[model samples]
Target: MNILLKMLLSMSIASVILIPLVWFLKKVFGQFLTKRKSYYAWGVVFFFLIVPFAFFFVQKNTEFLWGTPSEFAGLTSMVIGQNGIEVERSTQAVIFQFIMDYVWVLWLMVGLIMLVYRIASYRNFKKFVISGAHYIEEPDELDILAEAMETIGLNKPVEVMINPLISSPVFFGFRREIIVLPSTSFSKKELYHIFLHELVHCKSKDMYVVFLAQIFTCIYWFNPLMYWMIRQLERDREYACDESVLSYLPARDALSYGDTLLHSIVKSGTYKESHAAVSLHENAKMLKERLEAIASYKKGKKGYISFLLLLILLTLIGILLNFYEAKAFIYEKKQGIEIKKEDTSKKTEFRAIDLQNANQDVTIRKGKTESFDLTTYDENSKAELVVKNGILMYKNANPNTQSAIIITIDADKVYDSLSIQTTGTQIKISDIHTKTMRIKGGVIIAHFNQIKADTINVTTGSANVHLTDSEVNKGMKFNGNNALIHFEKSSFNNLEMTSFLSAKLNDLNVQGGLSINSGGQLDARNITTDTLKLIAGNSGNMKFQNTFVKKSSEFQDNESMLLQFDGVLNGQTRMSIGPSQTKFVIRDKMQKYAIDAQSSQADTFILNQSIVNYPFTQNLSAPNNITLTNDSPFNNNFNLSFEE
Candidate 1:
C-alpha cells in the first residue's frame, strides 16, 4: 500500500511537470508536428505515469545495484532494540500515522467512485443511442460503407446504424466496431465522406485511446490537469482522424469534407461526450479550429523525436536519482604474515609503557618480576622495544602485517603511565596497576579484567571494548565511533563514556559520577552513581534498569528516549526530550518522588497509564524531585508509570 501511494504521488508530480511542458512544446513548434505525431506525443506523459511501477519491480527482483552486506542489519538492529519495545505516541503522531495507513483507502474510494460514475454514464448514453437506432438495410448505404472501409484499408466488418437521438456521426465499441450516424438525408458523396472519417477512427483505434484516457482520469481524479489532458487528447484524436481521412481523399474533396463537418456541427445538440466512443464533430468550441486545421493541413516535418528522447532521458534520470540505494562494504580479514610460536622473554625495568601502531593481539598482566615476551608474525619485521628514562617504548615497523604479533608484558611494580595504540588489534589487560592508562586504536577489540588504575582512557573507531571486574580510582573516559562498549562489575570514581553507536553497562558502580553521551542505544543495569548526566541524539535511546543516582542527575535527548528505573531515585533529576516519544517506568512505587512535567499542548503525557494534562505536577513537596520538559510543536509522548 505504501509503495502504491508512492507510485501514485510520483505519477501525479511527473504529470504536473511533463503535461505542461509537452503542451508548450506543441504550441511553440506546432508547425513542425504533424497531426498524428502531435497526438502521439501524449504517449510520453502516459509512459512516465507508469514508470514508477517499473522502478518498484526492478528493485524487488534484482540485486545488481542494491546489494549490501548483511552485517549492517545486525548492527542496525542492535542500535535499535530487536524486541520492538512499545513506546507511547503523542496525539499528532497518532493522527499522522492513521492518515498514512489509510490514505490509500481514501484514494481508492474516490477512484472507484469516478470509475463507476463514468461507466454508468457511458452505459446510459449507449442505451439511449441503441434504443432509437436501426441497422442500415439500404443496398446503397451498404455499398457506400464497403467503399469507405476499402478506402481506409479496414478489413474488419463494421455495423452501421442510424440513430435519430444523436445529431453527429460517431463510432463506438471495441471488439465489434459500430458506426452510428444521425437520421438525416445525405448525398452519396457526403455519406461516403462521413463513413470514411468514422472508419479512419476505427483503424486508428481512437476509442481505445479515449478509453485509456478515461481510466487515467478516473485514477487521477484529484488532479484537475488530468481532465484538461483528456479534453486536449480528445481534440487531438479528432484532428488526427481528420488528417488521416484527408490523406485518403483527393485535394478538392477536402472542401466537401469540411462542408459535411460544418453541417454536422449546425445540427449538433448539447450531446455529452462518451469515453467509449469517438464522434465526427465535438462541439462549436472546437469546430472553428477543426475547420481551420482541415484547410491548412499539410505534411509537417517530424522534429519531435529529439524532444521525445529528451523527455525519456529526464524521466530515467529522475528514477535513478530517487530510487538509488546505499551500498554497504564488508571488511574481510587477510592472511599472509606468519606467527612465530616461540616466546622471546626479556627482562625490562621501566615505570611507564607505550606501544604504538601494533596490528596484533597484546596482553599485559602482573608478574613477580619485570619481563616481556615477544611473539612475532614475521621474523623479518623489525620491532623497536627499548627502555629509556624509566619508560618502555615499543613500535612495530610493519604495522600493516596481517598476522598476530603478540607482545605479553609482565611487571611487578605499579607504572606511572601505560599507553597502547594500534589498528585492528585485539588487546587484553589483567591485574596491572597504573596511575594513568590510555589505549587508542581503529577497529579494535579490547578487554580489561581485574585491573586497577587511577585514570584510564580509551578511544577507538569501529571497536568493541569490555571492562570486567575493573576499578578506576580517579576517572575513566571512553570515546568511540561505530563502537560498542560494555562494562560488567566495574567500579569507578568518575566515569565518562561517549559512543557514536551503542554502550551497555551491567553491574557497574560509580563512586563519584557517571556521564554518557550516545548517538545510538545505551543500556545500563544494576548501576549506582553519585551523579549522572546522559545525552542522547538522533533517535538514541537510554534504558536504565535497577539504577540509582545519589546526587543531581540530568538526561537530555534530541529524539526518542526510554528510561526504566526499577530502583529508587535519590536525586533531583531533569529530563528534556524532543519531538519523539519518551517513556519513564519506575517499578519502585514505594519510593516517594515529586514529578513536574511540562510540554506543548500538542503533546500527551500518560501518568500511571492514564492521560494527564500538562504542565502537570504531583507530590510537589516530596524530597526527591523529577522534572520532565518537552516543548516542541510536534507530538511528544511521555509515558510515566509507577508499579509496585
Candidate 2:
C-alpha cells in the first residue's frame, strides 16, 4: 500500500513538470503542427501519464519512504506495536505524511465524478438529438447530401434531419447515424458547403476522436493542462475538417467557404460549451482562426516535417519525465549518516558476513572507509559481534534472546563472495558492491541496495525481500514459501524465482531466461526478459506488464490461476493455464504469436482484436485442446498453452 501511494505521489510531481512542458510546446509549436496530426499528439500525454507511475514503481529512493524508522512510527498506528517501540514525528511531518497516504482516494473521487458527468451529458445529448427530429426529404437538399457523400466515398446509409432546436450543424449517433442541421433555409451553395463539411467529419472519423479526447480529459482532470490541450485538439480537429472540405473544392472557392463559415458564426450556438457533438462555430475566437486557416491553406511538404518534429519532441519528453539516476550514499562517524556521492576509485573488496539467530530489526549500511561498527539498543542483550579473517559474524550469546542490532560497513569494500544465513532476523543492507552475494534465511525482513553480484541466491522460509538499485550479472534465483519479494530497478542475466506465497518484480532488466514456480500469487511489471517459464501448482493470480519475452517461453499450471498480461508477448511462447482463466490485454503495437495448448475440463478462449475500444472477451469452449496458429492477423503474435 505504501508503494502504491509513493507511485501516486511521484505522478503528482511529474504532473507539475509535464503540465508546464505541455503548455510550452503548445505555445511554441502550435502553428507548425498539422491540424489532424496535432490532435493525435495530445495522445502523447496518455503515455507520459503512465511513465511516472512506471518509473516510481521501480525506484525505491523517494521522499515518501525516507527517514529514520522511529521518525515515521507515529504517523500510523499500524507501524506502532504492542512492544511500545515508538517513533516520534514533527507536526509538519505528520500532516505531510497523512496527506501523502490518503491523496489517492481524493484523486479517485474527483476522476469518478468527472467521468459520471461526462457520461450523463453524453446520454442527455443523445436524447436531445433523438426526440422531435424530422428527417429532411427536400429533393435539392437530398441531392446535395448524396453528392457530398459520393464525393467523400461514403456509401453507408445516413440520416439528415431538420431540427429547429439545434443552432449549428451537428453529427451524432453510432448505429443510427444522424446529422442535425439548423432549421433555417439555405441556398444551394451554402447547403452544399455544409453537407461537404459534415461529410468530411464523417469520412475522417473525427467524432470518435473527439469522444476519446473527452474521456481522456475527464480521467486526467487534475492536470489543468490537459483541459487546455483538449480544447486545442477540438479546434485542430475542426480545422482539419475545414481543410479537407476545401480540398474537394476549387482553390477560388476557399474564400467562399470561409464566408459561409463566418455567416454560420452568428446562427451557430456556442457548441464549445456543449461536449455532446462535433458542431460548427465553437465560438467567435475559434471562428476567426478557422477563417484565417482556410484563407492561408495550401498544399505543402512542411506538414510532414512538423509531424516528425512533434513526434521526436514528445518522445524526448516522455524519456525525460521517466528518467531516474542512482543516488549516492556516504556516511562518517562524526557527522552521523549522510547521503552523498563520492569516488570509490581506491575501494577494497567487500567482506563476508554470517548472521545467526537474529529476531530483531537489523540494519547494515555503508560507511566512509574501511571500518565496521556494531551498536545495540539493549545493553543487557546477549548479542555479540566479531570480525575474524575478514568475516563478520553476529551471534546471540544467550539461546533465547533477541534485540535490535545495527551493523555498519564501509562503502568502499567490494566483496568477491558474500554470504548470509539468518534465522528470524530482519536485516537491511545498503550501499555495498560485491562480486557474488547469497542468502539463506527464515522469516525475516531483508532490504538490499547498490549491491552488484554475479549470482544472488535467496532461500528463505517465509520472508519479505525488498531490493533496489542492484544488479546480478550471471543469474539470480529465489527459493522460498510464503515470501513477498519486491525487487525493483535491478538488472540480471537470468532469474529463477520460486515461492509458494507471492512476489513482484518491477522495472527490471532481465537479459536471460526467467523461470518461476509458485503456488501463490505472482505480479511482475515493467520487465524485459529473453524468455520465461512459469509453473504453478495451486490457485494463484499472475500478472505481467510492459515486459518483453523475446525467446521461447512456456507455462504449465494445473490449478485455477488468474493470469493477466498487459504488455507485449513476443517470440515463441506457450502457456497451459489448466482450468484457470487467462486474460491478455495487449498494449504493444507489434502483435504476433502462436499458442499450442490442451485442457481437460471445459475451457474458454477470448480474443479482442478491434482497435475501436478495448477488445472484448470472446469465450469459446474447447474440451480437449486448441491450437492458435501464428498465421492469424489478430493481436500480433501472442501464444500460450493450458491444461487442468
Candidate 3:
C-alpha cells in the first residue's frame, strides 16, 4: 500500500471503533471516574492516531525531495545572489527534503492540544446557587439554561428546565449549568442527585469530548476500528459520571435517583452541536449501558487493590499506545498545474524468482519445452513471475510503483539474492544441454548459483545493446539477424550465428568453442576461447577482429559436454584455437569446403565432403559419406555421380 492509503486506513479504523467504544465504556464506567480522568481518557484516545500520522509525513517527505519538474519560483534558501535561480540535483534534493520534512517532533502537538483543551475547559473556579429557571416549556426542561443564557453566570448555578423528554429531575450535562430543581415535588435528596451528577460533567468538561472524538473520526472516517473505539469511550464515560454522583448520595437516595435515571435513560435524545470536545446524548449502545449502570452500581470503592491494579493496567496500555500513535492523512488537491514526485530506490538482490518472458520460457523440467504462438511481441508484453519470492519477480508486489524487490529479512540472518533479465535466456537441468531461444530483439541477462541455464540469443532490432555478467551454458546455440550482442564472463559451448551480429565475450576465461554459422557472418574482436570451430557456407564469413585469451577451463568428462554443428556453411568460418580439446562433427555441405583434412594429423576422419582443420587435437568426422562414379567398387555399372 502507498503511504497515504496506509495512513488513512489506520486512522479510520481506530477512530471509528474507538468512538462508540469510548461512549459505551464511559456509559458503564463514567460514574466511577474522577472528572479529570474522563477528559484524560478522551485525550488518551486521539493519541492512538500516530501510525496513520506517519503515513502522511512520509509522503510529504517524498514530495519535498522532488519538487515540480516544471518549476517557477525558488524557495528562499535558493535565492542566494541571482534572479532566484537555483537548480537542485534530483537525488540530493530528495534526500535533503526528507530531512527537512521533519515530522518526528510534531506528534507532541496532538498531546499539547489535549492538555491545553483540558486545562482551558476547567480553568477557573466559580460557585453559584440560584433558583431553577422555568424549564417546563422545553424538553430537558432543565435545559432552561439555554433560555436563561443571558443571565446565567459562570458560577455553577442550577437554571431549572424540566426535561420535556423526562419530567423526573435527572441531571443532564451542559457546561457551567448547575440546574436547580423545583422545590414543590422534589425532596432535598432527589435534588442532590441532579446537582452532583451534572456538576461532574461540567467539571470533567466532557461536553468538549465529543468535539475531540469527532476530529479523529472525521479524519479516519474509513476505519471501523477507530469508530469502535469511540463507542467504547462514550459508554465508559457515562458510567464514570454516574459513579461520581453516587459518591455523595445515600443508598436510599441512590435508589430514589435510579428511578429518575431509568426514566431519563429511556427518553434520552441527541444534541445538535458540531463543536469539538463536547458530546451530547447517548448512542444506542451507550443508552443500554447507562440503564444497566443504575442497577449495577456497586457502592464500595473497587477494593483498593483492584483500583491499584486497574491503574497499573491503564498505565501500561498508556505507555505502549501513547508513544506510538496511529496516524491518518488528509490531502487537498490543487487545480490547473500538476506537481508530480517520483521516488526510486536502488534495486537490491532478494531471493531468486522465476518468470516466463519474451525471449525464453525456462522449462521447469530438463529438456522440456512450451511455446506461445502469438509471435508479434512488443515491449509492453510483460512476463508474469510464476513464483515470486519478493518484488524481484513481479512489479505488482511493490507499493512504490518503481520496480524493485525487497526481501523481508530477519535482523542478522543471511539470504541469497538473484535476478534475471528476460530476453534470450535459457536453462537446461543437466550438463551438455542446448535450448535455442528465438528472440526477435533484446539482450538476455541471467544469474544462477551452481548450474543454471543453457544459452542466450540475440535477434535483429532497431536498438543499441548492452550486456554485462551474462552467461550461457555449454553446447548452446545462437542463431539470428544483424544484432549486436555483448557479454562479460559469459559461458557457451560453440557460438555460431548468421548476419552482422557479433558478441564480444570480454571475459579472460571463455571455455567453449566459438563458431560463426554459415547462413550469415559474425565479427568478434578480442574474443579468445579453447577448441575454436569455424564453419562457412558460400557467402558466410567470421573474421578475427583480433580476439585473445590466456587460459581455458577444460572440458571435464565425455558425458559433461557436447558441441554439435548440423547447419551448412557456405563461406570461410575461422577461429584461433587455444590448447583445450573440443570435438566438432560437421555433417553436411561437402560442396562448400575444399576438404582441408590433409593438412592436420588425423585421429578419426570420415571425409565424405566436410573438413576439420588440425585434427591431431580431437576427432573430426562426418556421419555417412557415399560417392559413385561410372564404375564404382560397390556398383560396377552404376554411376551415381554421372546421371543419364
Candidate 4:
C-alpha cells in the first residue's frame, strides 16, 4: 500500500499535480511572463511543474535499482526467517550503493539537458506570439464572413470582428468566439472555404489541445520530440479538419482556400499571437506546406489500414507512457565500509537482520569510487532505491522479489560494464559505462549512457526492456517466447531475432544505425539520424521510418549513411541500387523521413502515408541506396524492399 501511494504520488507530481502548477504560474505572472502571452498562463505552468520531476524521478530510481538483491531474497526469505540463525551464508550484505558511478556522469548529464530544455520552453511560451499578417480589411467584410458562416450551417452566432490592429486571414480565436478578417477580401465561396478551415480548428476543439500542448511544452522543454508531437497533433487535427471540410465544400473552392492561404503568405511573414493557440497567419513556408498537403490529400474517409497504423503508433506511445516506474531510496551511513563496483558484498545485509527485528533502518555507506549489490523479495521494494551520500537504504517492504545495484562514482567520469545474473524478473540501475550490460531478466529499464547494452535475456519466459539516452546502442534479442526490448536514443545492430513482444529501437540519431535480422519483428521509427544500416532477413517487419528534424541545417548536414535491404529493385536482378537521400529518426513506432527521389518505388517506401506537415529541402541527397523491389510489388510485405 505504501509503495502504491508513492508511485501514485510521483505520477501525480509529474502530470496532474504538475499541470496545475503551470496553470498557476500563467495566472500569477500573465502580463509579466510575456509581452507575447499566447496560452502563457496555461502551457508553461503545466509543462514547468511536471516535466522536470517526472523525468528526473523515473531516471534516478531506475538507475539506483541497477542491481539489488531479489533472486536470493525470494528463494530464502520464507525459509530463512523461520531458521534465522541457520542462514549465515549467501552473498554477504549486497553492498550496493547508488548508480552515479564516474562512468555514468555523462549519462547523468541528460538530466541537466532536460532541465535546460524545459527552462527554454518556459521562456519561449512566455515570449513567442503570432504576429506578421497585415490585415487588409476593407470594412463591411464581417457581413461576407458572417454570411459564409451561415452557408456552412454554423448558426451559433459567430462574432465578426475587424482587427485594425491585426493582420491575416479570417481567424477564429479563443474557443472560436471571434472571427477576424482583413478589411479587404474573400468571395462567398472563398469566405466559406476559409470559415470551414477555421471551423475545423474549432470543431476539433484544437483550442483544448493547444492548451494541453502548452502544458506539456513548459515541463518537457528539453525533449524536442515532445514539442514535435504537439505540432504533429495540431497538424493531424488540421488534416482531419481538412477532410471534414471536404465533405461539404467543393474542390475548386477548397483549392481557392489554398490559393488565398498562399496570398496571405505573400502578405504575412508569420504572426504568432503570443497566446497558447496557433491561428491563421499562413506564411510562405506554411503556404507551401498546405499546397503539398492538399495535393496529396485523399477525398474520403481513411481505411482500416490507415487507422491500424495510427492505432499502432498511439498504442506504442501509450504503452511507453504507462508501463514505466520511478523508484526512490533513503539511507543511513557507516564509517569506511569500502565497497567495490563489482562486489556483491552486502548482498543481503545480515540476512540474519530483519526490519521487524532491527530497532532502526539499516545504514550502509562507502568511500569514494565504491559499489554495492542488492536483491529484494518484495514487489513494493523493487520500485524505488535511494542512497544519501554513500549509504544504501530503502523503506516499506514487499513480499514479491526483485534485484538491483547501486554504484556511486564522480559526477565527472564514465564506466565499463554492468552485468546481471539472470535471476529475477526485473533489474533497475543507472549511471554506468556505455558498454553492454547483460541481464537475465524479464523487465529492464536503464537511464542515460553513450553506448547502451542490448538483450534483456530470458531463457524460456518473457522480458520487456526500455533504455534511454541520446540514441539506442544495441537492442534486445528474444531467445524466449515473449521477450521484448525497447531502446531510446543510441544505435542498434539487430539484423535478426524473433518473438511475441520483440525488440523496438527508437530515436536513432543521424549518427545511429539499425540492422534488422531475419524472421525478427523490428519496428524502427523516428530515426532523426542520417546514416543507418538496415538488413531485414528473409521475413520480418523491417519498417523503414523517419521523423522531421527540428534541428537547424548547421547541425543536420552531417555525412551519415542510411542503408536498408531485403529484396531486389531497379530491375528483377539478384540485386539493385540507386541514388537517394532519405534519413529517418527512429522513434519506437513513429518514424519521419525526408525522401528526395525523382521516381517512386513500388516496393520501396510506402508513399501517401499519414499526412506529414514539414518543409521540403532541395539540398537532400542519398547516393548509395539499395532496392527491395521485385517484378511484382510487395504489398504489406514485412520483409525488406530495396529501392533503386
Candidate 5:
C-alpha cells in the first residue's frame, strides 16, 4: 500500500510540475519554434509521468542508514510521519497482502472495464469505416494525394476513401495509413489544402500519437488530469500538422490554404466528432487558434537547443523527485545484544512465547532472550519459574487451590520480548523497554511509568489498562470485551483497537492513525488522532471532547451520547451519525467551516459570530436544507461558531 501510494503521489507531483512548465513554454516560445516542435514538448510531460513508476521498480533497498529519495521522500514523510514508525515484518506483510488482494484488484477491474468499452467503440468505428466507405477512383484526386505524399518523401500506399458520415478529413491507421474524406464537393484549391494536411498527418505519424493517447486514456481513466493531457496532446498534434502543411505552401497562398481549412471546418458543423481517427478540423476555437498561428507565421530558425535543454532539465528533475531509499531489512527481525545472568551454573535459554496454564502473579519485563533473572518471593506457595527458548514463565506448582504468588522481574538486565497471562493476577510492571509486549487472557492490572516498545498487543476478557509517560513506536492493538483503557501523557503512532459488549477510552492519544471497532459505549476525552475510522454496533453511545483531528475522519452509523469539539480540526470530515439524537457543540469560534446538512426534519444552527452567517438559520422550525459556509479568505482565523 505504501509503495503503491508513493508511486501514484510521485506521478501526480511530477505532472503538476511539468504540465505548467510545458504550457508556459508553449505560450512564450510558440512563435520562436514551429508547431511541430511544440507538439513534441508534450513527450517530456509524458516521460515525467512514467519516471516515478520506473524508479519504483528498479530502486534497491538499503540498510537503516539508507536515506529516502529526495523528491518523493518529502511526500512520503508528509503522510507517514518523520520518525518512520517501524512495524514488524509480519505486520507489513499482512498490510501488503490485504492491499494486493483488495485494492489492487479493484483498480485493475475498473481499468479493464474502461478498456473494454473503448475497444468496443473503436471496433464499431472500424465496422463503419469498412462498411460505409468506398475507395476514391478519381484519377485527378488520387494523383493530387500521391503528389502530396511524394513531396513529403512518403512511399507507403494509402487508400483515399470518401464517406458522408464524416464531418472532416480523417487520417486513420499507422501501419496502413488511410485518408477518409467527407462526401462534399471540393474546389481544386480546397483539394490541394486538404490533401496536403492529411498527408502531413501521415508523414508525421500523428496516428501513432493518437493510438498511444487512447491506450493511456483507457488505463488512467480514473485520473482527470490524464484525460486533460491527452486532449492537449491531440490539439498540439493538429497544430503541428497544420504548421507542416503551411510550411510547404507559398507565402502568397497561405491565406488561400487558411480559407480552405475554415470552409471545410464550417461545413463539418464546426467540430470533428470522430474518435477513431485524427480529423483535419477539430473545433471552431481550435481552428481559430491555428488560423491565427498561420496568419502570423514568420519562418524563423527553429530553436532546437532551447527545446532540448528544457526537455533534459525536466527529465532530470522528474528522476530526482520520484526516487527514494528503500529499507533492505524490511522482511527481517530486529536483533539485540545479549546479557549474562547471575546464575552461572546454567545459562538462561532463549524461547518464543509460553502459552501454558500459569496460576501465579507474574511481573514480566524485557530482557535478553539468551539470559534472564527469575526471582521468587513467598516460598511457602511453591512458585516455579520455567525458562524455555526465550520466554521466562512463572507458574504456581499447585493449581487445585488458591495460592498467592509474587514474582519480581528484572528485564533491564537483558533484551527480550515479554508475554504475561495470568488468572486473577495483580501484575505491576514499570520502566520496561522491549521490542514487543503481548498480554492475553489475563485479569491484569499493569502500570507503566516509562515503557517503550515497538508494539503492544493486549487481548483480555476484561481488564483495566493504564499507562503514563510511555510511547509505542509502531502501534498498539487492544482486543478485549468490556475493557477500560486509559492513557495519560502517552501516545502510539498507530492504533487498531477492537472491543465488544462495552469499552471505554480515557485520554487516549494516537500520533498517527486509529481504527476502532466496538459494540459498546465509548467515553473518549482529550483524544488526538491524525486520522480516525470508527465502526460501532447498534447499542452504545460515543462521547468525545478536546479532540484534535487532521486529514480526515469517517464514522459509520455512530450513535453518540454527546459530541463536541474543543480543539482544532484541519481537514475534511464525514459523519454518519445514526439515530442517536446527536448534537454538536463547537466552542472554537475561529475555525472556518463548510457544513452540509440533510434531514427531513429541521435542524438548529446557532451562529454567534458576525463574520459567519447561514441564511437558512431562520427556517429551523420547518423542514429545510441548509448549507453553511464560512467564506473567509484568510487561513489563520476561522469565521464560524456553533453553540447551544
Candidate 6:
C-alpha cells in the first residue's frame, strides 16, 4: 500500500469516527458550548482531512533513508543462457505492477477534476455577482456600513455592493471583502442588522474557512461523510456569526435581528450559496434552528477555554490513533497471513541436508541436536522434515507461505553438503561446518556469520548477500541478476562473481584470486587479492578503493565504462578502457611502475598531475608494468597520481 493512500484511508476512518462524536456531543450538551466554540469544534474534523498531506510530504522526504525499497523497484532480472542475457518477468507480477502504477494516477486525476470544478463554479459565481452589482452610493447606506465596520473593529476597507439579482446578503472575496445585498425594501433597523451580520463574517474571516472546507470536500470526495461534515460546518459558521452580531447589538434588538433573519429566509430563493462565500441566509430548513438559537442565546462565562483544552487533547489522541491505524492497515494489506510457531527436536543422525521451496525467513545454526522450529500461517503450510538415506530433507508444500522457519543441525559432525533453494526468503546461517554449500533463490537475503565452509555457491535472480566473520576454505562463487554482495572481515581462497545488472563488493580478503564479470556497475572496496580480473560488458562504471592486486591484474570494458582505481599494484596491471575516463591513484608512492599507453584516436594522459601526450611510454624497462589501451572514436582521458 502507498503511504499516502494509507494515510488517506486512516484519515477517512478517523473522520467517520469523529463526525458522529461531534454530532452526539452537540445533541447532548448543546447549551454548554457557545455557538463560536461549536463552530471551532469542526476545525478538529478538518485537521484529519488535511494532515495526511503533511504525512505525505514527510514520507517523500525521508523515504530514501527509512523506507524499504520494493523488491521490483528498479530491478530487471536477466538470466544468462546460450542466447545471452534475457529479461525475465512473471506474467502475474507484470499485471500487478501495471495495476499498481495506474491506480494512484486515477485517484489523482479524479481529485483534481473535483477541485477544478468546484473552483470554477465559485469563480463563475463571483463573476456573475460582480457583473450585476454596483457600489452602494446612498448616504444613509454608507453611514450604516461605516458604523457596522466600526462596531466590528475592522480597519480594512470593505466594498458594499447592491446586486439586484441576489435576495440575501452575501459576504464574498478573500483578500478584498465584498458584501453584496439585494435592492429589497426593509426597515432601518433591519438594514443595520443585515450590515452588521456580513461585516462580522468579514471580520471573523469566515470566507477563508469556507474555502478550506471546499478544498477538503474535493480531496475527500469519495467519503460521503465529508459532505455532511461540510454542511454541518456551514451551519455552525452562520450560527457563530449570528451570535457575534447579537453581541454588538443591544438585548432589545435581538428580536429585531431575529426578524431580519426571518425576512432574509423569506427572500432566500433568489440566490444559492457557494462554497467560496458566506451568506446571511442559508435556507428555510436551517432558519428555524437559527431563530431558536438566537432567541435562547446568552452571554456566558469563558467556558470555551476548557472546551478548547479538551479539543486539543482529543485532537492529539486522534492523530496518534490515525498513525497507528495506518501502519496496521499497511501491515495487514502487505502481509495477509497469520503465523503460528511449532518447535520440534529430533535425534536423527544425518550427514547432509537439503531445504527447498521456502517463502519465509529461515535460520540455520549449530545446536546440540537436530531441531526444527517453524513459524507458518497454519498446519497446512508446515514443511515436511525427515531424514532418509543419510540426508535430512526439508520441504514446504505451500511454496507461497510466508513466515519463519529455523533449523538447528547437530554440531558434532560436519555435513558433507547443505543446499537450500527458496523463492522469497531471508536465510541466516551461523557456526556450522559443511564441505560444500549451495543456495539458490529468486529473491534471497542471506547473512552468513562465523561459518566454516569448504566451498559456497550462491545463485539468485535478485539477492542481498552478506558474509561477515566467515571463512570459505576452498572458493566462493556467486551468479545473480541483481545483487548487493558484501563480505566484511571474511576470507576466501578464491572469489568469482557474475552479475547481470550490478554488484557491490566490500571488505573482502582473497588468498588466490578475484574475478568479476558484470553487465552493469561494479564497486569493490577494501579488497586484498593475489590476482584480480574485471570485465564489464555494458556502460557500467567500475570503481575500486583500497584494493591491493598482488600479482597480475586485467580490466576490460566492452562499452564506455568509467574506470576509477585508488589502490596499490604489486606487479603488472593492464586496462582496456574504450572512450571513457580513467583515474588511478597509487596508494604506495615508493612502488615504481612503467606506463605503456596506446590509443586509436586522440587521448590525454596525465602522469603525476602533468599532462602527457600519448602514445606515451615511460621507463619501459621497469619491473612493474602498467599498460593502458583505448580503441574508441572519441578522445580518451587518463589520470595517474600518487596518493596525497
Cα error of candidate 3 at position 622, Å: 99
**TM-score, cand. 4 vs. native:** 0.32
Tell me the spans in candidate 1 whose CA falls farther than 4 Å from its real position: 53-91, 268-273, 300-644
Worst 10 residues of 6 by lDDT: 331-340
Instruction: Report clash pairs, candidate 6.
Output: none
Question: Each prediction's Cα lDDT score?
Answer: 0.76, 0.67, 0.40, 0.40, 0.63, 0.78
Expressed as tens digits, the lDDT of each residue in 379-405 for candidate 6 is: 566566777777877764576666676
- Can you write out model 1's per-residue Cα lDDT over 25-120, one digit (the tens) per residue? 677656766787778878878877766633453433334222232222111112226775323335664565556667888889999998999899
What is the C-alpha lDDT profile of model 4 across 1-644, one tens digit per residue? 32322333344434443343334443454333221122322333333333323334444323323333333321222333554533222343333322222323543365467556645653463333223223335444556556556656666655544433344543434533555554344555655666666765555556666656665454344445455545544544554555566656666556666675666544432334433444564345655765676665445443444334433443343333433433333222223422224555444222111112111112222225444444544545433444433233344434243434343443233324333343343444444433443444333332234333442232324555555663224544434345566766755443223443455666755433222333446566665533333333333444444433222211111111222322111111112222223232222211122233222334343333332221212222332222222222222221222232
Task: Judge candidate 2 at residue 629 and give its lDDT.
Answer: 23
Backbone clash pairs in model 1 (N, Cα, C under 3 Å; residues 3+ apart or in different chains), count: 0
How far residue 170's Cα lies from its native spot in candidate 5, in Å, is: 0.7
Per-residue C-alpha lDDT of model 2 across residues 386-461, encoded as one tens digit per residue: 6666677676644355455566666666776666665646778788777777777785688888878788888888
Per-residue C-alpha lDDT of model 5 across residues 1-644, encoded as one tens digit per residue: 44554455456655765677777877787666667878898888777665554344343443222222222221211223578642233455445555544565566678788778877876677667657889988888878887787778888888888777767877777677778877547886788788899888887777777877777666555678787778788888888887788788888888888898877855553223446578887777888988897797766558797777767766776565454322221222223522223675343554433534555455544433333333444456665566655566665555444544333344454335767666655555666677887777667565556777889887876667666777798998888777666667778899887874454455667888878888676666788899877776666666566777766676664443333334555455555545443434554332245556333333333445443223333433322222433222222122235542
Over 4 Å off, model 2:
1-33, 53-86, 266-273, 324-644
Q: Which candidate leads the pack in lDDT?
A: 6
Q: lDDT score, residue 77, model 2?
A: 30
RMSD of each: 27.4, 20.4, 26.1, 26.4, 28.0, 16.8
**Which candidate would rank higher by lDDT, 2 or 3?**
2
Leading candidate by TM-score: 2
Off by over 4 Å in 5: 1-9, 53-101, 269-274, 323-644
Better by lDDT, candidate 5 or 4: 5
